[model samples]
Target: MIEILKPTELPLARETGALVAGILQTLKARSVVGTNLLDIDRQAQAMIAEAGALSCYVDYAPSFGRGPFGHYICTSVNDAVLHGLPFDYELADGDLLSLDLAVSLGGIVADSAISFVVGDSPQPESVALIDATERALRAAIAAAGPGVHIGDLSHAIGKVLNAAGYEVNTEFGGHGVGSTMHQDPHVSNIGRPGRGYRLRPGLLLALEPWVMADTAKLVTDADGWTLRSATGCRTSHSEHTIAITDDGAEIMTLPKG
Candidate 1:
């Protein structure tokens, strides 16, 4: 379902977005060599609870995933990209990691994701992949505005990824978010401009652009949730929850001080 937030709902959304961003920033800072994935999830849970917020992932069970995600955050490392279920694994230096988070505060939901390298390895390919996704995410956000179509955002994102020599995957992309986690208006990573749903004030969209290094194909992990690159190449994902306003698109998921 597509949800348009009223002016009053936007404040709650901003709060939720700030919480998601703050948690991600905190996790990014703490995720280093020897950091356990489960520990990261534990930290996220504590932060959410302390803020009196709710996790959108803990009990999330969709058709593509195992029942009850049972995790506070998604910790996708190296080849893993989307729906990364946290498990017993310690991060190693130079491991490409992606943290995707969502939370509900004051009855509104916000979602965001970030990709980074763990520790000091600084692999060039990994950095490039992460940079591409971040650039694509920015391009998509720039394209978002009143009267803009969803495809415009997708096209803007796809161009950046394609130019960076990465293949785009449409299987899973961004979507609408509001009082609930996932909503309608599937925002693909690639599409034609001037098509799909038109943007309007008060609309909230989670625009994500993710790409695998070599191929667009994906393989599901044995856990039935983690999505990995078919070629086992490194991957990256960047996302933000944006709210449409009269001036333009307001990015809600920015790290809070």
Candidate 2:
């Protein structure tokens, strides 16, 4: 469902968004070389519990995934892009890692994701892939406002990714998030403007723009969760929870510090 949150709830949404951002930032900072993916998940669990927030992923059993996620956060490495279930794997220098998180605080939910290099030795392709997703996310946010069509945001994001020489996968993209983690009004990475739902004030959307280094095709890992590039090429993903306003859009998932 497409939900336009009440003004009173915007503050709660902001709080949830900030919490999600802070957790991802903390995880990223501590994810140095030799850090295990399972350790990262444990840290996320502790932080969520300390913050008095509920994890949207732990009990999540969507059609695309097998059973409950049983994890607090998603840890995508290198070629892994979406629904990356945390496992027992140590991060190495120059590894591209993406952390996606969603949490509920004050009865409101917010979601976001970030991609960064694990260590000092960053690959040129990895840096470029991360940069493209970040740029696309920013463009999508800038295009969101009351009366603007969802397609406009998609177009803006698509232009950036396509120009960067990467293809987008529409199977999974951004979606509405408020009372629940995933809602209606699916926002694809690419589309034609002037189509789809019109943006409205108080509408919260998790605008994510992810791209693979080469092909758009995805292959699900044996874990039945992590989505990797068909050609095993590296990938990157960037996302933020934004609230549409009368004037424009306000990004709620930015790290305060």
Runs in model 1 deviating more than 4 A are none
Q: TM-score for all predictions? A: 0.99, 0.99
CA lDDT, every model vs. true structure: 0.94, 0.95
Per-residue alpha-carbon lDDT of candidate 1 for residues 1-257, written as tens digits (9 for 90 to 100): 88888898888888889889999999999998999999999999999999999999999999989869999899999999999999999999999999999999988999999999998888999999999999999999998999999999999999999999988988999999988999999999999999999998999999999999999999999999999999999999999999999878999999876
Model 1 poorest ten-residue lDDT run: 7-16
Best-performing candidate as measured by lDDT = 2
Clashes of 2: 0
Total backbone collisions for each predicted model = 0, 0
The alpha-carbon lDDT assigned to residue 2 of candidate 1 equals: 88
